[model samples]
Target: MGWRRSRSSEPHADLRLLIERFGWAVEHVRVPRRSTGTPSSYTVGLTAAGHPEIVVLGLPAPVAQDFLNAVAEQVRAGGSYRPGQRTGEFTDEDGPVVFLRVEDTGGLASARDVYGSVEALQLVWPDSTGRLPWQPGYRNAPGVQPLLGQVP
Candidate 1:
């Protein structure tokens, strides 16, 4: 299917298109919020069982990598994440899952750039879980660490 664009008044059209392109059904698109550099902050809601959500925050170029790495490590280790006071427990009945946080230029967003960011997230889709959503059968077969090597 081709990329779907939201109405002119709607925001995060590119993010919506990218999320859909990844094959994960989009459940909701929260209204964009005001940001410093970009016109608005975007969040793409997913229909996954665990209520997964993806938000592209407007962070400075320098700390973006560190932030991504820190979040990845936290999620991998099953620790409480301080981002907005939400615990970083990435999991559901299927197994542990991660919320893909991608960094992008704090400049104006374009369909091309959003697509690129989504692509980057796919490269690390499962984070440290080492399992995809479709691999639940295999993941539960035997000798599998459901929580990506972390207990509970």
Candidate 2:
């Protein structure tokens, strides 16, 4: 499927696609605010259990990677990562889910709280220019995917 053109419009539509494809849910209400940038991103409760995960600060891959790498470095220094859970809106409803986080990014003080710190990593994947677009209608976009009725 294609990416969304503008997250502000029909943001949930793109989020739904992400859930269907990436198994990640984006909560509309919990979207972070008061960011250092426009079209900002807040910590998306990466996990269904709300244990803290990746920071969803609207940013491109390179910039996000920098934040991630920095946090990763912090993790390597003495933190850790795990399959943690966080509470969030799933398919527009509350539910449990999972995602990956740095475990810690605030240096030694938060070393033990790697997962929480991971929530604080402050990374994001933003497309401010609407450079990409969610399929005009996902139904029209076709590609390799779950095969038709093969008996689950």
- Candidate number of the best lDDT: 2
Ten-residue stretch with the least lDDT total in model 1: 143-152
Residue-level lDDT tens digits of model 2 in 1-152: 22212355765555545545533332222224554333322222233333343443334434443444443343435543444333222212332222334444442222223233334332312123321123232232122111111111
Which ranges of candidate 1 are over 4 A from the true structure? Answer: 1-56, 82-152
**Each candidate: RMSD to true structure?**
15.8, 17.4
Measured against the true structure, the TM-scores of the candidates, in listed sequence, are 0.23, 0.27
lDDT of 1: 0.32
Q: Pick the candidate with the highest TM-score.
A: 2
